[model samples]
Target chain A: MRETESAAEARPYHHGDLRRALIDAARRILETKGPAALSLRAVAREAGVSPAAPYHHFKDKGELLDAVADEGWRILNEAMKAAGENAPSPRAAMPSLGVAYVCFAREHPALYRVMYKRSRDKEALPEHLHEGEDSAYCRTRDTLIAAGADPSDPVGLELATIAAWCAAHGLAEIGGFQQFAHLKEALGGEEAFFRGVFEHMGVFARGLND
Target chain B: MRETESAAEARPYHHGDLRRALIDAARRILETKGPAALSLRAVAREAGVSPAAPYHHFKDKGELLDAVADEGWRILNEAMKAAGENAPSPRAAMPSLGVAYVCFAREHPALYRVMYKRSRDKEALPEHLHEGEDSAYCRTRDTLIAAGADPSDPVGLELATIAAWCAAHGLAEIGGFQQFAHLKEALGGEEAFFRGVFEHMGVFARGLND
Candidate 1:
């Protein structure tokens, strides 16, 4: 009886707000406990909502995870764009973007894993995520094309993009391992270690041109 | 009363065999059901053994996982060595080794994930896995030296090795993703996709020398 007409009108707005809150809660859980611990119920609990509340926003855990991964990609896309835009020249952007990609993974290891984890499950990702033109993958491809890569030859462009991406991804994945601690020390520090790898990117990009 | 001295004598051998079986069972589970499905009890059940049996071989789940990851590295080491040895020349070995690294991951996705997953855990990997001289990481280092990288300059050699590793690892991780399906199709097929990536390795290596 206390719930009046104004409260009813505000219900849809609350629903939208709850969806964002649930995604934020899921991200926190993913960062703290890793992907295995991320469940819709757990997210609801983290967000201080009832167990059934998350279902109104997400159909199941998969949908929630996909949302979290989408958020990760959006943040990553921004980081890569910033790195490219701040660089002095188009060719210089490649190594900056490479460094940024690895640095993003280092900063958000759990989120990085979740972003890539969707690829393992066959049906989880939406069609737009898979499309080359609209994805962060395209950012790398476009950067490569801008940086002296032959835009006309799609095959060559793809190969160059793959090589650059592989190098960045590999470095990011291994950067956090204790086994590589010595490499970091030997190279002076973490920044130096990253710089050394980026130097090789310059060599690699020049080689692509040749 | 029926358990006598002879049965006691047989117990040690059974322990050793069970340990091997548990590792094998864990590998099978990892490959089929993915790493999340891997648990000591699950592995024991998969191997047709008692629930308590795995505890006799591994202290806990972490110990069991480390053992499985160790076995994965052993297999990967052999694959890499075989690839390096089969190449006609020292310089020719780099791209071959790169291809082998990615192919090993492709062939054993779950095990590859486990092998890399150990790097994330702070204390799980054995000391031997960290030894620079004995690891598969060293194989890349050695190949770089063979391909005319200055072995005396450890920093430079390490950087080159990282570059090669990052490229290979990136390709392997994304190779299975549907996002790259169009790229693969454009390259003609899966084999051609791998071949294109390997060809870029040759260019990257040559650039390193210059």
Candidate 2:
């Protein structure tokens, strides 16, 4: 009996581990085939498990996708936090965080798309992740407040935050498109192009402070 | 012979009009089902034509999509131009153009998504629409140059253009997502929310000028 239990544990199918395995498989599918191609059966096939195995963990594809998006937000929040922590000051952290935001989108285009699927139904999002309180959003807002924006003026603060957020998000989405290939080539390479954008972001950030 | 030709034209199967019909059908499908759900057969079915009919007009789905995206850009350029032309001055035109951009995306989410599909291959885009010379992109650049950015400094002009573009693009993309529904509600409604964003863009534009 002891040998059989140890064998089951060593087989990588131990109880409660299937959920994590499914999410990992889903991320792989999302990264490679994109959200449109993702399905529970595909994830199960990628995980080398029976289709019924995923059903045991997720109620349906939406539940599984919600889990994937949840994980994506968590990963993004960590990346933004790390970028802020590594920067020299709150002022510098602003653009660094913006760079990190765009870089995250570039690295995980499919996952990022899935994370922001356009359903127009807020219920589709996981309950714990409120957009206003999202770690990254709050971090950006706090940075703006620290940089001399009037914290008491809610509208002013909101507008400042939106300006910064919009600029970063726009760069990420547009930069991801192929239409800018010529501009990227002219700027030397992708990294060089992003560097130029980041430098401009520094100016935009200072503008916000003023 | 004249009567027969008139009859054929009235039948909605006019020889030269199939391409236009197919494109119109594709737009209906795109607006209803979105880009992910778009397919050649579905477009043909929507047009009440045989499955093979679309092939006569478009070799493949990519060709059809390119056509749809091309139409999207032409419409978007016109919208931006109208917004700029109606504004009182170049500075006023900046935020008007930004508002028009976000409003365009909100009004045509699916078409906008198809127009900016994330293909890293430059060949995917139509050759005529050069990124640097794209009407909307160039218009934004010219507006920035007109707003006091030194035209002599190419890099400065480029960065300023990018900052403005990124902010507008970000607002459009982010506003399309449901996560910001609460923010929209808090600001009163969609128009009110957009008004707030446009107001912020005005401030950011002044910052750029400074």
Candidate 3:
């Protein structure tokens, strides 16, 4: 970034709003054109700012994308939180949150793809996503605990959290298949289809014949 | 296709072996150079075959990618089938298949991504993938029935199958999360980590405090 330090000093002011505007520009581009067309220069152009403006807020396109994905995760975390709060009971929060997650993905397909695909090559999910209280993963864990998973059993707890997260993630990806269209219609609609998947999110534990 | 009808006819012979070779070449390319580097011409070059020879089998890169994805799905289905068969009991096959699904994704991350991303623009999972006797999705349905989900209850059966599929899919996507590194180490090795996630694939029916 120091390579452009003279340009940065020319601005001589904080860019709190510029940072937000640049992210918004990247998102609009993601929605309209897709990820391939997104670049720092494009984002700057979209925000109606000078060519070097985006660099002031983000070192490069990767950093800018990370910010966009951070925004996406925040939105998802909020939705999951709301789902947990709105459920009829602590137990019900499990599937409600799952439903919320799938809905979030369906609503923001581009953002959803970016959020997950952001770290496709990274050794792990971006730390900010799973770390801290704002994390959507943490919300899942909280709901799992409220739903009776033992907090003391770290292995079981993490496994269960991964289970819930995966179920929701899987449905979000493949639940829209034509094979499931009839089932979705029979279940009443999109949300019902989500519920159907989640209600049975667990194995049939009893395995009737057993 | 008529545009190249004469060219295709120029080689009036069965390409059974050539088709297989082309697909093999594609796999090698995918593994070595990643998806962006995969093209029909590249496959031909890799196979040490003439560029036009690939044309006899694949009209374009998209068509070849579909074939590649088909191979991927077939491998996945077979793995799931093997897992189901190897499990001690039909009831155990449910999670066994889930474990197999994730294992397949882990082993073939590039193929796995191609398999799903192939239909990112389409209305559904590829028709052949979900349609025939060999489909991985069908395998999931069969495992659900074997585990005692009611065949008569179409909604319930499909829901169960979807839940299992999504859980596996989800884990395959996020299961390696660095957040779970310690948990994976504690659980044993990677396969054990897969099992831990699968073992708790279902929701906690009892809600301990209940």
- What is the C-alpha DockQ of each candidate? 0.35, 0.34, 0.43
Q: What is the lDDT of residue B139 in candidate 1?
A: 77
Highest DockQ against the true fold, candidate: 3
lDDT ranking from best candidate downward: 3, 1, 2
In order, what lDDT does every prediction score?
0.73, 0.71, 0.77
Off by over 4 Å in 3: A1-19, A36-45, A48-59, A204-210, B1-22, B36-59, B204-210
Ranking by TM-score: 1, 3, 2
lDDT by residue (tens digit), candidate 3, A58-155: 87777888889888988988998888789889877777788899999988887888888776756477776677775788878877888877799877
The C-alpha TM-scores of every prediction are: 0.84, 0.82, 0.83
- Model 3 local distance difference test score: 0.77
What candidate 2 gets wrong by more than 4 Å, as runs, is A1-16, A32-37, A118-134, A178-192, A201-210, B1-16, B33-37, B118-134, B177-189, B201-210
Ten contiguous residues with the weakest lDDT in model 3 chain A: A201-210
Tens digit of lDDT per residue, candidate 2, span A125-161?
Answer: 3444435654787887776665556688887677767
Best by TM-score: 1
CA RMSD for every model?
A: 4.8, 5.0, 6.6
Comparing 1 and 3 by DockQ, which wins?
A: 3
